[model samples]
Target chain A: MRLIFMIAVLAAGLLYTFYAFNTLNFLSASGRLGPGFFPQILGLGIVSMTLISVITEARRMRATTNYFAAPADAFPGSALLIICMSVLYLIGLRLFGAIPGSIVFLLAMFWMISRGKPILNTVIAVMAPVLIYLLFRQLLSASMPEGLIPLPF
Target chain B: MEIFSDLMMGMSVALHPANLLYLLVGAFVGMTIGVIPGFGPAAGIALLLPVTFGMDPVGAVMMLSAIYYGAMYGGSITAILINTPGDAGSVASTLDGFPLAQQGRAGPALVMQAVASFTGGTVGVILITLLAPLFSQVARNFGPPEYFLLAIMGMLTLIVMIGGNWRLGVISALIGFALGTVGVDLESGRSRYTFGSAELIGGINFIPVAIGLFGLGELFFAFYSGSHKKRDGEMLTYDGKSNFWPNARDFIETRFTLVRGSIIGFVVGVIPGAGAAIAALIAYSVERSVSPRPENFGKGEMAGLVAPEAANNAASSGAMIPLLTLGIPGSASTAILLAAFLMWGLRPGPLLMEQNPEFAWGLIASMYLGNMALLLISIFAIPVFVLILKVPYRILAPLVVVVCTLGTFSVNSSYMEMYIMLGAGVIGFFMRLYGFSPAAVVLALVLGPLAEESLRQTLTISRGSFGIFITRPASLSIIVVTIALLVLLPLIQLYGQRVRKPKAS
Candidate 1:
């Protein structure tokens, strides 16, 4: 897992470096340090350091058989589920707007995480959206996602 | 006499009913955020930053700064009660805090910590009041070369303090610098890495990235660690009836410890990258070393709890010196504060006090009042926070996600920023799991543009000769300090480890 993350970073670093070198100028036409100068250094540094980290992490993992062993406390299953749910919630926000999308998301989330409490979940799902709507929209007058399907007050 | 009158003007500003109300709200919110394990001031401030958009700049900054120092007071509550440090700054508090709680001295422990924190915080503000003007006067002479070197010094000191994983820390900071290079080049009128998106043209908004990384990312990691499933530890209860307050011996015995811890914490806090956690740990170590009863150090010693509490609170104050005078944030939380300052069109530097006395001194004065408020809150409001702790992480997780998402959207009403926040959250989760420093990334992101601009200007002035950094007295001084910090931080870390190993064993 660590090796994969490091490799991902390295790949991104390489792409960044490629763009920095190919697209951006190191010195401006007027002979000043241009936009690429900083990014070039940063990109190269990231690529090199990440490559070293990957190599070191890979070597260490090879020597340790239990490197893949999950800790007793880890709940990767639930964590992954939450991530998926969050993505769905984002999609819901796009479709149904802030209030309705948040209501659905909260209902679904509470049902999943805090089971056997429909009454509490329902109350929270309804009230939380209303409260957040009040706080963001009414009180602060901040913009909320009007969504493709706008809601009437 | 001049300082005295300036403070009086600040007091008048801070004492306004509206400003006081904001201060109270910030203090309350800060404490609430701090009580939750895994949620620190960085996340709290980011999560709330957008809400301050319509607020008066002084009130907004006062509230944010309150949240920053207020977290220091709130973190210890959980550390003492549940053996879980709410933030890194409270880790040392758990050493003696939990032990003291276990010994059934939880009440005394809690009150004494509040007192110690109040003392340290107030003393820090006093020092700030006296020294900030002097520091500002000196910092006014700094040129581009000096500023650039200072930025590098901040990053290097942070990386060096990351101990064995210094390479990974560097990589994390590099990632931040990379992110910071997004958007149009202000100088050359060329977009660097925006990929031709209008949203990308403005570069990444700091609020969403901050909220995602520190808020959602930390929450997700907490879930991954099975914190939601784990039942709370047996809480040591303290009814306000009996044995609640500390005895006279508690204060008398630790009289010198409080002073020593405050001074150490303040000094450490003034240094870039050495934050409250280091200050607390170093104070604990120093207190132990100098104690007549070293054996009693971690065994529910009043001084043990007092030293770290004092140190962490003072360190929080100490960190403000750089931010207020030099416009450089030494830690993730302060970086968010800097972002807030910029959002309000208030650039914090040497001229901040001269140009915006009302905002600067108003903030400084609020800290004095804030420490008093926090002391009262920390003592009288314990039961409220204890109730907060009873609320499980499982239920809180989704609501937090909702807040982070909606908060991101509220800032610009832009779906793209929300998406960026979500992406950053996922990436931040992986970063946390893999031992990379998210704080370092955020700090670098804040400092990257400043560092780049200053370096370019320095080179331009020097005709592309880097020797200008050595020739300038201010730049040379920064170089000497950076080198010294790079050499000294590792030794300090070593000493902290040496002291910590015994307690761990």
Candidate 2:
């Protein structure tokens, strides 16, 4: 898994390096380094480092079964659920209004993470967003997105 | 005379009702996070960065700084009673603190930690009050080459001295430098990597990236790592039987030790990359060496408890001097504060004292008030902190997610920034899994652009001659240090290994 993760990073670095080399202009007509110089340098560095990381990871994998001392299963289903919930919450915040969207998002999250206490989860789900709304919108006067439902602060 | 008058003006600002309230709140939040065993001061301050958007810069800094030292005070509570160091800095505390707890003297251990922390923090502030002006005076003479070299030296120190895989640290910093390039170029007036998006012209906002990386990334980690899962530990219940306050004899015995640790911590704090954890460890070793009862150092010795606790708090304050005087962060917490300074359009340096003396001196003044606030809170607020620990991660996690998402959005009301935050959070999660230092990346993100700008400006001034850096004495010295750290030290180590190999053969 660690090797695969490194491989992916190496691939990304290579692609970014290729794109930067092709598209970005490193030197201007005036003969000085342009805006692209630093990015190209960074891209090249990333490629070299990621390549080194891949080789190092492969050598360690060959030396031992438990190379990185990582957990047997670091990513469980709850983690996946949380990730999905985060994406869904982001989408909801854009589609619905900030307050209404957050209320639903909070309730769903509270329901999932709570210890099967519906009443407590529900109360928290309702109160948490309202308090946050009051803090950000009313107190801080932040300009939140007004989508389907306009929140009256 | 000018410094005194400026400090008085700062005192008035810090004493304002609004700023005072925030200081109390920040201290409470800091303590809460400290006792919880996972949420350290870095995340606590990062979590609250957005909320400070509405606040004045002085108040914002005052509140955030209160959280930093307050967390130090709170971490000792758990270290002494529960026998678990709240953060790495408090690991030394557990050496003697837990043993004292086992001996049923937990109350006295806690009292000593608070007093030691107060003493150290007070001394650190005093040192800062004295030393910051001298440092600022020196900093005023620095040019672009010096600034460039300073940034390089700062990055090198962070990458090498953080006691991790240096390779990963470099990669993390490179990644940050890459991200920093995503915005429009300041000098060339050209877009580097915006990919033709209009919103990209304004660049990636620091607040969302910060909130996502530290706040959401931490929550994501907790879910996967099970760090927030309840562990079995004996919680010491206070019965109001033991003396809560340290006796005069206790202070008299530990006074020199406290002073020594404070000075060590303050000096260490001013240097980049060495933070409270290193200070605490070094202070513990120094105290053990100097003590007559060296063998009793970790055996519930009073000096053991006082040394590291004082050192960590002192180091926390000491870390601020560089951040305030030079616009360079010495540690992760200071990096977040620097981000706040940038967000407020307030650059910290010698000119900050000249142009915005109220904001500059106000922060220093608030440190005094914050230390006093932490002393009072640490004595009277342990139960409150303990109660906060009872709020299960199940509830806490969701609330954090809401806060982070909302905070990210509130920065610019741009859904694109929120999405960028989400992406940064994911990247941060993987970076942590891969042993990359998120703090290194953050420091790079905050300093990389400034460093790049300075480098370019120096080049322009030198008419593209690379010799400009070496021509300047200050820049040359800093460049020499960077080379030693990045190159010479490694070669020497490799040579040592080769000589040892031949001996073994």
Candidate 3:
């Protein structure tokens, strides 16, 4: 079942990659080297490998107990934390911008990492991101996203 | 004698105060990251790369090189204390490293790692200094066929050698080739894989993927495996004080492991697909099999710690060989290093050695000096690293996560990158659960683009004859080797059983 799923995903990707390559006009011999040649071959490689893996995995399953077993919990609580944190971090970015959102995000993360020390960890996390923001933005002149809380002068 | 004169000149360039300052700063920063849990030398180097973008090519390379060795020295600290390798390369160290700590030999374990790393790195640097020019001269003769062959050879080994289901590994590699196709098709103005998303047109940046997979993926794994028993605590009071120097007998025992590992590291480092972590693992396996007291392994045996550390360090220097010579990056760290070169408006190719001998020679010299510095400082610094670990994981986790996110944000100010990071993090978290090797996926993601570019170029030249790869000697040899490995795996396993049968008897 998992092998099937993998093959399906691989096929989808291959098809998309092939179409993507062909859609762009790559059928020419103009320059020293033409454009579309690399993409098409890459697409084919992806397709061939995907097929090969599926076949091999299927064979292994037939010979042994099975191939590609999904565990009881493919997505666990800890992974959920990552999902929530990432989504929240993205939300923070959209709402606050990279700097201020990162500040809040880092603070919460610090709170998470410390396990029990909330306030102190939050302070360190918040301060670190803010200072990093200031350093990169002000000194390095790299433009960061303008989050809900803009970087204050 | 002539080589001695060049070495002296190289030292002169490396000794400049400006260069020295960067080296110190780089070493200090690199060690800081290395000492921290979860950040390997590659990740450490990636984190520090932004700081060097501002310096001159020579200074930048010097500092980066210093950090490379410094982080190597730092990676062992957490391994000994926590039994958790901060980077994959140091995973072997945990076999004996944490055991030694448990047995109150933490000090010696660390000293072993540092000294071994320095020896390997020093030898690797010497070899690189001698070998790079020779390789580059050979590379100068390379044509389109050679580059094409090199790419094929690179992909072939990756498919055969990396640990995993071989079929799945190939799938991963092919996917990587696809991703490499996403960025502005370098050979042509036409874009592929952009799918009208402007953010992606610049392409899926490999750095963010690397950081997300190694850094964020690891953090996610730690969280997922939170229920796994953590080590009780460090043996803070166990203070056996052996001389920091590894003695002659120690050398006699570990010399073969060190040499074998150095050679493996250098060779692996030169290959784009076979990286340092794999090299270290392979070396450690060899060390285990070869050791007279195999049972002593994973219980803080000196041999276990020495072999992998040496391989990991040598791999660092070895990776530079391909980059400097063939203008190809053997590993992710070197890949990032290559980006720095590009930003400085330097194109690495056949003529690179001829055009930038000073920059090349200076970087190699600095690595030599960096090795000496790492060996000198680590003698006194291991104690301090243990102290750092005692601060508690709870605090360290928060700090590391925060710093990682900030570094992620800084790498590109794009909040979108953070989203990509977040998405990748979530995917990575689940990948760990499903038994997918994050390293495999990450390497696939990292090299996917390169493979795609090479494949596309190969076909463009061949005009539909994919067999053109077989026509080239280098490419054909690599492809043949890959096929042989694919066929020989079961035979090798059978041979292993045959050898072990007598032992079983």
Candidate 4:
């Protein structure tokens, strides 16, 4: 079943490459290398590798291997939590810059991680990223992206 | 003698006080992260890159070198104690060390592993000093087409060597390759599969995806499986009685294994697609083939313990071949190293060796001394590392997740990457629980962009004919090897199974 799924995906990739190459123009009468020239060649390679993948999948379909096993149920509620944190991080970094954004991400992450930890532990984990960022940006002068609300670099 | 002279020159630069201190710090941090389950040298290197971005090129490389070899030293510790190899590179060590642990010989097993790693590092460093310039000269002969074929070969390598079911490996490689296609096509600047997201114009980074798939995925599965409802075992406690040094007999037997393993490792490392994991596997198999008492392997044999360690450390040295000589990276870790190099405005390739011999040679020298420092530090650090294992997974697991999240977020300061990590983490966890090698995914991600770009360049040069792959001698031969690997790997596996069937009956 998964093989079929993969074949479908491979087919789509090849078809897309074919279509993309057909629609794209060379955009030049002549040059050392035309833009379309590279795309077409890449499309061909993709098509070839995809073909190899299809043949290999078919061969494996005939082969014997155990497929089923117990599925895992670990880390419920983690993805959503991750998504929320990431959104806040995206919004926060611009406002606070590297130091504050990192502090927020780290402390919140520590809270998520520490489970029942005391305030001190949260503060420590939070401080780790912030301190590292300060050391890099201020002391070492490593440049970083300043998001929405820029703090002093 | 030339090797010694070059090495002496290398030491002159490596031993500078500032350089030496970085090496020490790199080794220490490398060991700490390496010994931890689900974190290894690559992640350690990735995390350190942005932090070290401002350092001088030599100092930056000094720390990375320490981490590289130090991780090699630390990998076998968990393999012995917890029956879990911290990284794939150390998996072979577990076959012997874990069994020795079962037999209450963990100390000897660990000591043996550490000694083997040191020897391997010594051999590997020698090869780097002697072989890099020579091999690099050969690598310069490669054109864009050849490098493209090399990446293709890397994909096929994962196809066979992936530890789990072959089907999943193919799927994992496919998905990884496809994901790599998401960003702007280098030749056209046209996005392939980004679905019109401006954020993905640069493509999906393997760093975040790799961290998610390996670190986050593993963490989720550890808790989700619920297999370990009860933790009732004395595996960690009693092993204190075993001697923590390889016996004279072990030394006598394993000396050749270390040498052979390191040599094989360097050769594999030189291969464009093959990396440390493949080298280690090949080393383990070579030792098995050459062992007088073959049945002793995988049953607490010192040869098993030493072969993989030597191979992995040597392969780390091997990876430097491309970086120093050809400018292409053969593995995921090296890819980051490349980025770090570029960050420092130091272009690494053919010109690098010619323009900055001291810098290049100095980096090589650090590994020789760094590996020695790793050996000494690890000996005294084992008792402490074993204690870290005592931390309950309940807390440690979440902490891992958080660190990976923060690490991902901090790298680009893009929360979009953080979300990508979570989604990729889920896919990766399933990939892992299903037996797909995370390294394969990482490899795909690392090489996918380069492969895509090169294939297009070669085609453009060839005027859109498929014959371009073979018309060029170098590209043609590399493709042949990839095909040969794909075909021969299955046959070899079948033979191994057939041979094992008789014994089972």
Candidate 5:
């Protein structure tokens, strides 16, 4: 699993490096260092470092007799589910509104984290979003996105 | 006399009734967050950055500084009672603090920690008041070349000393620098990496990224690791019978240790990359080595507790010097503070005194008051902090998520910021899992634009000659030291390995 994460990270770094290099114009006659120059340097450095890390990890895996001896968190399914829910929450808030979206997001997350203490989760999930909306909108005067249901505060 | 007058003016600004209330609130929040196992000063500040966004600059900074020192004071509670270091800086405290607690002397231990923390924090602030002005004078001579070199040196030292793995640190920093370049170019007036998105023109706000990385990322880690699972073991509690204050004799005996640790911690804090954790460890070892009863060290010795508590608190204060005087953050918390400085539209450096004397002096004055408040709060608020720890992370996570979501969105009232935070949180989680330093990324993100602009300006001034970096005296010295550590030190180590291997063969 650790090896997989390393590989994934390396791939992401490489992909980004390639994209940044191709996207940015590194050469400009106006100055020795252009706007793109720093990003390109960073891109190159990331690729090199990721390569080193990947090679090192690969060697370590080969040398180790019991690969599982290395302590790594078992990436819990619940955690992955929570992450996905958060993504949905963000999108929901974007499309609908902070209040309605927060209610649904909070309910699902609270239930998930509490492992189905439905009554407590429901109570918290309902109350927290409203309280947050009031505090942020009324007290702080924060500009929040208005959606299907308009907020008074 | 001049410094005294400046500080007096600073005190007037800091003592504004509203600022005082914010200071108390900051200390309370800092202490509470410090008591929680997975949260520390950095995360707490990041989470609360939004709250300060609408505040007066002086008041906001005073509150944040309070939080920083308060967390240092509050971190010892869990270390002493539960044998869990609430913050990394308090890990050394657990060696003797937990033992003292187990022996049913938790009150004396707690008192010792508070008193030692007070001593260290006061001394550190004193040194800051004296040294920051002197450093400001030196910083006045720095140009683009010098600033560029200083940034490089700061980054290198952070990677070598704190990141623990140079390769991982480099990768993380590079990724951070890349992220920093996401917005429209200030000089060229051309969008570099926006990829045609209107939102990308404003670039990635460091606050959301910070909150997500340090706050939400840690929450994700706590969940997956199941570290929040309630431990079945009993935690040592105060029985209301023990002395809640260390005896006068104990203080009189350990006075020298507290002063020595404070000096060591302050000096280390002033140095880039040597944070409170290292300061505490070094102070602990120094006290252990020099003690007449060295054998009693780490076996519930008073000196052991005093050394780390004093040093870490002092170091937290000391870390402010570099950030305030040079605009170089020595640690993650200072990096966030640096962001705060930028957000408030005040640049911290030599010119800060001239440009924003009120902000600079007011913050320093507030630190003095904040330390006193922290001492009072920590001593009185220990039970409240202990109770807070019992609140399950399950309930806490949702609250944190909601706060962070609102906070991130409040930055620009942009929902896109929330999405960015979620993505950054996931990346930050994996970065932590893979032994990469999140601090490195953050420091890079904060410093990258400065470094890049300086480098470009230096080159532009020198007509594209790279020699400009090495030709200037200050920049040259910094570059030489950076090279020795990054290149020569590793070469020497490899050569030594080869030499020892031949003898073994």
Candidate 6:
């Protein structure tokens, strides 16, 4: 998994360097260092460094027989679930607006994580969103996602 | 004498009702953030950055800076009580802190830590009062070559401090430099990586990226580590029923320790990338070596707790010097503070003092009052923080996600930025999991543009001569210091490791 992540970074670095070389000019029309100069250096640095990292990681994995084993306490499933819920929450915000979407997401998340305390979860879900609305929308005058179905408030 | 009047004027500005209120709120919030294990001042300040948008720049910065140092004070609470250092800086405190608690001396340990922190923080502020203007004066003579070298020096020092993971740290910094290359080129008026999007023209906003990386990334990493599933096992209780305050002998024993820790911590803190954690560990080592009762060290020794408590707080204060004088952040938390300063249109370099004396001095003045307030709060508000610790990570995790999302969205009202934030968060989690430094990434992102611009200007002046860096006296000085730090820091790190390894076994 670590090697895969490093390889992915290497691929991105290659694309970034490719753009630097092909699209951006190394020197400006005035003969000064241009946009590509720094990017070229950074891109090369990233690709080379990440490649070394990948090789080092691969060697370590090969050396260790239990390299593939997960730690006893790791909860990758819970993290993935939370991440998926966050994505859905964002989509829900686009569909149902900030206040309503947040309430529903929080309530559902509390239900999933905390469990067995519906009333407490419901109160927190409702109160948290309302406080956030007052703080951001009313007090700070910052914009919130109004969504397609905007609330009357 | 002039510094005195300046501080007086600053005190007047900081004494404003609104600014005072902001300071108190900031100190409280900072302490609260510190009590949570794994969350540090960087995450707290980043998460709260958007909320300061509507505030006056002076008040907002005061609050943020309060959060920065207040966290150092608060981190010791958990170290003493639960043996879990709230942040890296507090890790040294856990050496003697938890042992003291186990010995039923939790009250004295708690009170002594607060006093030591206060002493360190206050002494550090005094040094800043005496030294910042001089540092600023020296920096005023620096040119483009010097600025570029300073940025390089900062990055190299940070990477070198990453020890065995130096390659990963370099990659992280390079990634930051890449992100900084987005938006239109200021010098040539060309778009490099925007992909023709209008939103990308202004480049990546630091607020969202900072919030996502430190805030959401840490939360995700905490979940992955199964922190939510773990129970808080038998926290040592401090009822204040007996021996709550340190005796005269305790004070007498630690008097020299406090002064030594403060000076050592301050000196270490001024060096870029040598943060509070390193300062605390070094102070602990120094105190042990110097003490007559060295054998008693790490076995509920008061000086053990006092030395690190003072050193960490002082180091936090010392970090502000570089940020204020050189426009270079020493650590991730200070980097966010730098972003906040930029957001408010307040450039923090030499001229910041001459042009915005009120803003600069007011921030300095607020620290004095902030330390006093934190001392009182750290003592009296123990129960409140203890109660906060009881709240399970499982219940707190979801709410934090909501806050991170909302905070990122509120900044620009752009879904693209939110998406960027989410992407950064996932990357941040992976980076943390893989021994990469998110702090390095954020620091590079902040410094990349400056470095590029300085390098361009230097080359232009020297007619593309690379020798221009060596020709400039200031640049040469920075290079020498960078080299010296590179040599010395590892040895200091080795000493710290030697101190810890014996105890751990």
Could you say which candidate leads in TM-score?
1
Candidate 5 residue lDDT tens string, A1-153? 567777887787777777667766675765456677887787778878888888988899899887755355554665677678778877777767878788888877766657647887788888988888887788778877675555563
Q: What is the TM-score ranking, best to worst?
A: 1, 6, 5, 2, 3, 4
| Residues B215-277 of candidate 2: C-alpha lDDT, one tens digit per residue | 777678778876435442335545446666666776788889988888887876776766787
Model 3 over residues B1-505: C-alpha lDDT tens digits? 6556666777888889999888877876777678766766666765666556557778887887787668777877777767767676676677777877787667667777887888778878888877877787777766555565565555555555544466655655565556666657776676676778888888887666656666666667666655222432344433546444555676678877878878766766666556667667667767778889987776667888888888888888887887778766655566666766765677676677678766766777888878887786777766666666566554455445555565666666676676666556655555444444444555455445555556556666787676777787766765666566546544543453443343335
**Per-model C-alpha lDDT, please?**
0.90, 0.78, 0.67, 0.69, 0.81, 0.89
B272-359 per-residue lDDT for model 5 (tens digits): 7667877787788788778898777667888889998999999999999889989988777888989997888888999898788888
Off by over 4 Å in 3: A1-8, A11-15, A29-36, A44-75, A110-115, A149-153, B227-261, B281-300, B432-505
> Model 4 over residues B1-505: C-alpha lDDT tens digits?
7657766787899999988998899998888778776667776776665556556789888898687668767877888888777776787677677877777777777777777788877787777777787866766778878878777776676567664466566656655666676666565555655677888888787667767776666666655554123243335633565666667998899889989998988887766546776677778877888899878777778888888888888888887877777666766677667766765677777667668777888898888888888888877778777776666554455445545665666567676787787776766665555455566667777666677667667767887667978787877777777787777656654553443343345
Q: What is the clash count for each candidate, in the order shown?
A: 0, 0, 10, 5, 0, 0
- TM-score of candidate 3 against the unseen true structure: 0.84
Cα lDDT for residue B150, model 1? 85
The C-alpha TM-scores of every prediction are: 0.98, 0.91, 0.84, 0.81, 0.92, 0.98
DockQ of every candidate: 0.84, 0.63, 0.42, 0.21, 0.60, 0.81
What is the lDDT ranking, best to worst?
Answer: 1, 6, 5, 2, 4, 3
Candidate 1 off by > 4 Å:
A151-153, B232-242
- With candidate 4 superimposed using the best TM-score fit, by how many Å does residue A14's alpha carbon deviate from the native? 9.5
Error of 5 at A57 (Å): 0.9
lDDT of 3 at B196: 86
- Best lDDT goes to which candidate? 1
TM-score of chain A of 1: 0.95
> Which candidate, 1 or 4, has the higher DockQ?
1
Compare candidates 1 and 3 on lDDT and give the better one.
Answer: 1
Q: Which segments of candidate 4 are over 4 A away from where they belong?
A: A1-153, B1-6, B163-206, B225-242, B434-438, B465-472, B487-505
Best by DockQ: 1
- Each candidate's fnat, in order? 0.79, 0.68, 0.55, 0.17, 0.66, 0.73
TM-score of 1: 0.98
